[model samples]
Target: MECVWTRNGSRCGEAASRRCDRCRAVGYCSLSHQVSHRSIHKIECDRFRRQMNRADVLSDFPFTFYVEPSKVQVVSFEKRCSFLARHGVHGLGMWICECSCGSSLINFDTISFIPDWLLSSELCPCNEPSISLQGRLSSWKDYCEWRHLPLSSPAAVILHWPLTVYWAIQLATGCNLLPEIKNELRIHYLGPEKELLQLAAFGELQALFPGVRIYIDFVGPAIPDRRSDERIDLHSYALCNDTACRCKTEMVSKSQAVRMQLHAGFYHDRYGEFSK
Candidate 1:
């Protein structure tokens, strides 16, 4: 993947001269760019090191797939605030999740206010909020602080497909893929989903990538309730050992990921209290 440079709203690369000697990750067309970029580069370089060390942090299991953001799309202050204010009545909003993978994931209807996690992330992009995700104004002429600081809870949902689906769909479409993937990663693959949120993400991806096939087996004990939220009440000791069976062969990998469809109605809460 080639690194393309965008400056002054125009992209230029391949012809650029100076490059970052540290990771050899970025390039500059002039000395001014190098100097101006140093502050951003210092943090980026440290983040790069942490990403490299992620694998060293003890693994609970071998990774089967991993998905990350392809691009950083910024929504303006007006757009973000308006969206949130309108949607607040429903306790829904979107926030940015800057994945360790060097991409930013847009999480919609997520329950958060300041998105402090994003602010604390190494991928915050800039120290000031004026430079919001979309490169819009950092300081509000009226309020005086960084634009993002004064902003109330997020208004619009930052829709995001499951990390798994994000990668799967990209691999399938090829053209719709994120530019960062083409430039940075040599091999981008989708791993298995264990958490319910991850599984939901997979379901969304499946909807998007209709062409891709997924094989699931009824390995867990049969539960009378197929409801998605009912999963929490299901037996926790379920296990499957039929390695020679066709189901095992069809699955992404025997121990890679687990899949169990939950009934709908997960978005709403019912039966206010415990019923006999």
Candidate 2:
């Protein structure tokens, strides 16, 4: 980790030996910088602390990932990064935007103007429709009943990518798209990456927009040449722990709710084709 405090448009960048006493998520090279950055850091520090202390942060799941003994319980993105670093894998796409070189700005190190959509834990199926969420969400218990997933499932950690896009759509359309565009929904999901591998995560979108024919265009360089411009159809809801709910008869006859197409190029390079 490196010092988060910036000096003269440049980061201190020195090895951060001192961490914020309250949140412990941010660090500084020295006591002086820590004190100097306190006023600015206080707002986010409080938020980080509150999120870290939430009851759901320490949630355990039935998955083998959680069943195995871990040195530390994976909670916040900061500790999650540290845990992954121990195994020689950098935690990309968590607490920071994915990049080829390295992370900056919205990265966990600085925490400046970090997107609340990525951090908010209250984006669940709750009582307050106006303040929390609309009927777009199914209860965690209900979701688990269908999915056989635990209520406190850590799947959110991985599912945040597509969820963020859904959140952005809500913000962009003033959350009125449900009534405005009812049957067919086309989402141009730009800059796709690891999402290309785990298409099942998009299944959650069905819950978000029930009975809607959702077409997703995953346009990015991550798509291999062999797979580009190929349309893959998802015939049924994502598979769950329950095999009794499905049978060979149903699997072969099901129609797709979510349809995906891969385009292996940067959006800018393929703008001519997409513009049409």
Candidate 3:
């Protein structure tokens, strides 16, 4: 039987470097990818091997991961904490988050954000305070170490400010069950104290179910009424927070492209300074 390694809906054929003699199910295209994956794969490789040995894989059916907008929801977290009636979320709920990696668990209030459609101008209500990226990297390194994640492996960054909303949505749509599913959703909130508030359990699920397709679809482009753009750079920029502010580039900057690039770095350093 041919060995197949599928992650986050992306497929990698049997590579000499990835094959594990002990577990025939999981193989990587390169030793580095396999080595980086050992943290999670080591625990589940045995089970996956047993399944593969049974000839459970369907031939001619290439593995795939799917991401669809309907599966995700964004909620409001700030509202639930505010005392002023007008400050909190109109409808708020509490929730708890657990890392499928068995690393840690967190509890907090939650809310949901529903995209306009494939694309929409969604507002963000997070702390607009400035921070130092260098400092953030210091702390994030600790968090990653604590969680046993590869320092170089892709990791998601979540802000601590909008805890309630992020938590609520995360609970509603547990993390992705496959690597591909997990990779599709990379959302970020702007705030200091970057605390990986939520990620679709993408890494864990991918490690556990290598063959499953994971998809997280957000209502973005293709919606006739929504001017959502697949190219984030084209999205309009506006203040996400409710705070009043001028539209000056320094006082206030908006660019989907810039924001997207920052998203990855933000996870690495939750609260770091941004230079113009």
Candidate 4:
């Protein structure tokens, strides 16, 4: 038997004698090995807790609308009206949203106008605006503190914008709908907030597509920008020319040649920025 902690080429060939006290699903050769493996195990543990939490939260709610998951498709304004009418909730001041899981329908209050970005074809599974905002804000604050980055820094500036994370993932996967099933996806990030909103986005994607192999390339701090008032340049971070940075080269090597893919014909100027 061998130690079960497999991370970054770490493997304990020694005989396994101890099991995790919490899950009891893995064996470790020594107490030190079990302690060392806790970091990676925490991710899965947290995911399990979140699943339980979701179940608990939804336990008391009644299913107002029930549509077979297989029959659901992207709905338009007219289609939304039909859906509302079918559910006998038309003119009830409700907002409809599709979950990121590609199944289940969410109804929101119609008091506030939902932004196109939030209501677009691809939306978060959480569906609730307050939950989404709180999650993003908490992740942002935790990431900033963990990375020891100032709130006013360029990296912080980019990480604070959750939409940027969405754009980055879209650019990396070359898909308009995020959290899509994929064999593997690689992302190269250049900034201090390495585990900011991007981490949260990746977590969501992982939950949606459990088999996805996500590889992240952290390229340290962004290149300095002389033209901009800020010390760190946004453009340089968007498009790296340094030979050491493998973003461009990796994109070129891909079969799709995504480096040549332009977003709204402004890929070269301000590639990462999300436009209306």
lDDT of 2 at 71: 21
lDDT for each residue of candidate 3 in 160-198, tens digit (9 for 90 to 100): 222232233343354332133332334333331112222
What is the per-residue lDDT of model 2 for residues 33-150, given as tens digits with 9 covering 90 to 100? 9998887687668756754554352243222233323322244333555544443334333323322333433322222111111211232221111232244332334333344444
Best by lDDT: 2
Q: Kindly report which residue stretches of model 3 are placed more than 4 angstroms away from their true locations once superposed.
A: 1-87, 90-229, 234-243, 247-276
Candidate 2 stretches greater than 4 Å from native: 1-73, 77-151, 175-179, 245-256
Kindly list the per-residue Cα lDDT of model 4 for residues 131-236, writing each as its tens digit: 2122222233333333343322222212233334333454334433346535765544434222321232222332222344544333322222221112211111
Runs in model 1 deviating more than 4 A are: 1-79, 89-157, 160-202, 211-276
Per-candidate TM vs. native? 0.22, 0.47, 0.22, 0.20
CA error at residue 91 for candidate 3, angstroms: 5.4
Model 4 has a clash total of: 0
Scored by TM-score, the top model is 2
Q: Cα miss at 229, model 4 (Å)?
A: 32
| Full-model lDDT for every candidate | 0.29, 0.51, 0.29, 0.34
Model 3, position 177: C-alpha lDDT score = 24
lDDT for position 185 in model 4:
55
Q: What lDDT tens digits, residue by residue, belong to model 1 across residues 1-276?
A: 222344553444445677766655556777776676677566556544544444343232111112211112233333444443343322211122322221133332231122111121121111222332332211222111222322221211221323223434343345443352221221211121112222222332222222233322111111123422342211111111233423222323222222333322211111111111
TM-score of 1: 0.22
